[model samples]
Target: MNPKISDSIPQEDKDFDKQHIWHPYSSMSKPLPCYHVKSASGVRLYLDSGQSLIDGMSSWWCAIHGYNHQELNDALVKQVNLMSHVMFGGITHDPAIQLCRHLVELTNPKLECVFLCDSGSVSVEVALKQAIQYWDSKRQPEKKKFLSIKRGYHGDTFGAMFVSDPENSMHSIYTSYGPDNIFAEAPQIGFDDEWNEADIEDFKRKIEKHHKIIAAVILEPILQGAGGMRMYNPQYLKRVRELCDKYDVLLVLDEIATGFGRTGKLFAQEHANICPDIMCVGKAITGGYLTLAAVISTRSVANVISGGRTGCFMHGPTFMGNPAACAVSVKNLEILRTGAWKSQVDTIEKILLKKFKPLMESGHRKIRQIRVLGAVGVIEMKNPIDVALYQRRFVELGVWVRPFGKLLYIMPPYIISEDDLNHLVYSLISVATDESLA
Candidate 1:
């Protein structure tokens, strides 16, 4: 938005957007202030206000390869000229075929079959449908209700919301709208805390007592993203897999947020060294270039669903396997294959840990606790923040860190430099320790 440049965009256009357009989780009548982003490249967003900001949220944690990535851009560009989109019902393309193979290679080998969809929520829907159909094929149609952990978030879709924490989540209002599902207590053991065997007891008991009725036991492995960005021990996931095996319950992992090297490992489930019966992947699938997600399942589950009463999976989105999205996704996996995210995440974690270390001793009453998992760093506040107040502050400080609920966190792009990261953390610390706001 440099007014001097011919390509610069005006900030006045946002007024029209604010009046007509509805943003995420906001009412159009009195929408939260919207920032006009004219363009973005790498880890920085160029605004219509002629100010540049270092992106900390990574556009809701999707653009892991950062914005306008060359390889992904080239892949998408090459695909659109051939064909932008086509019905994925019967027709297929090379992009979808290639992306699925790479997805299988990155994820669990047992999760060999991929069901491509438009977004993360749809992928969860596909997983739920797979579980239900698998049970029906086995003549256990009664086992339809899902069992999930408390404070866990899968997606915003009805099926996904039902299995998420019913009472605590923002989606709680829609609890009665979706299917009634079972929920175990949220794991109490912190990510780096001492192993608490008792933490598994409630989950173990829930599965034991309701195994007959539970269609699947679903949870976000190791790190639960939307559920307050909490991280738990990998042992909990390991034990969950064991119990699922013992009780004949399928484990569905929502790796939409934790997949693609976000949690130090390629997938958060890998921390437990276990494979899920059905796994959902999205977010970084195409390096945030386009909308895409996939539900990968075991060969047996795929066979059961295929050989079921309907003779086909019930759900089929029109844009299920978009060629352009798939093409970009193939290149995205190729980028991740370089194994650069490991060192990147390690460096981010170290920077967050070191920078936030002084804040712990600063004893800011507003900050409840500080936690870091891989590339994510969170400041759990004693109370929820005023979104407009903190957002304006972040923009003024030359960074973009969206503060929601009682959590102020940053999940930056993996390619961020040390100086950019330091500034990002500094911005958070400033917001957290700002005595006037406190």
Candidate 2:
């Protein structure tokens, strides 16, 4: 039998949650089955039913160091003892300062200014505001629209929602509610596929036609997450930078999913050897220990907005720069800087390539494509599989993976053992090989 709720949580609370608490992309009236996790350690999730499953999603690709990390734990504890939070409007703290400094230094040298926010979506909001304000400062308020690619996923907030690929994303219904931002075709070529100039022609034409009204060109860099686990070549980004420069438009790269070595680099823009005018990073920033995101910008963009009539950026979250989050994030950055993530991601990539090769080669009739980048491995099916059924199967098989749309993917924690990764691959293969579940 499954255990009751945690000692701290009443059984009634669990019952209430089932009836009222809506999960991501879930309907409140017809909720999907929910699993109860008691605790997590390293790369495994311990469930209330006394089952242990290797985590394949990394809690949506944030916990790079894995769960229950001693360093991250100690950092959070120490900060809580000092203070949990303080209003960032008038006050400042060393934890936030240190975290921002590390972020600026670790990113391209040109990205010097930082705005710490509560989540990835909020950081994107702040970036959008900064871009708009920068143009407003120059009296070019007409430069209000954004240009982005199809099959791109930024975030769910209003401004972020506007830039994401509407039809492919969950926010399609809200498209009518959000701004009608320009959309270009996603690169036709795959990440490993040879580049073709024709793939970017439509994007170029869109930008050239819309440059006057386009404030910024925002994208997920090389890897587009959520909308689909689509990975494209860096030359697309290279061309974006050149075009943005030519049109005097700001470039914003949303690295919320790809930052901090998730894409075989500390930042995905490094693959193109370019620096965006503004960048939004979150998810792994605090090692998934806390809700924290940052909008990093070049000093030029910062000065332009601040020097304008407003005299300051107009957005602030209540929990902006929570000391606990920053303190833990500082420690997380220290751990990431130790340089284990790079080699670890490389290993994960190799294992994924080796393990998934069979499915890619032999399962072509059922599989659409197989993609691997850094720690991310995805098997795209010709049609969407049964989500609840597949999830239950993975749980029973001692692995945890969340499938969405036609993609069954894993973005495992960096600290995952090679053996654990192999098991995850094995579980996925088992399902792909079983047509009954399809």
Models 1 onward score TM values of 0.96, 0.97
Whole-model Cα lDDT per candidate? Answer: 0.89, 0.90
Q: Candidate 1 on 1-438: residue-level lDDT in tens? A: 112221244445556677888899887898987777889999999987678899999898899989988888899999999998999988988999999999888888898999999999889989998999999988999999899999998888888888889999979899767788998998873888888999999999899999999999989989888889999999999999999999999999999999998889999998889999999999999899889999999999999988988888899898989999999999999999999999999999999999999887676878898889899999999988899888888888889889888999999999999999999999999988898884
Candidate 2 — which residues are off by over 4 angstroms? Answer: 1-14
| Model 2 TM-score, all chains together | 0.97
Clashing pairs in 2: none
lDDT of 2 at 148: 95
Q: Model 1 off-target regions past 4 Å? A: 1-12
Q: Compared with the true structure, what per-residue lDDT tens digits does model 2 show for residues 1-438?
A: 333223455679777987888899887887766778889999999877677889999999998889999999999999999999899999999999999989988999999999999999999999999999999998999999999999988887888888988888888899888689999999863887888888899999999999999999999989999888889999989999999999899999999999999989899999889999999999999999999999999999999999998999899899999999999999999998889999999999999999988777776677888899999999988898888878878877888899999989999999999999999999988877677786
Best by lDDT: 2
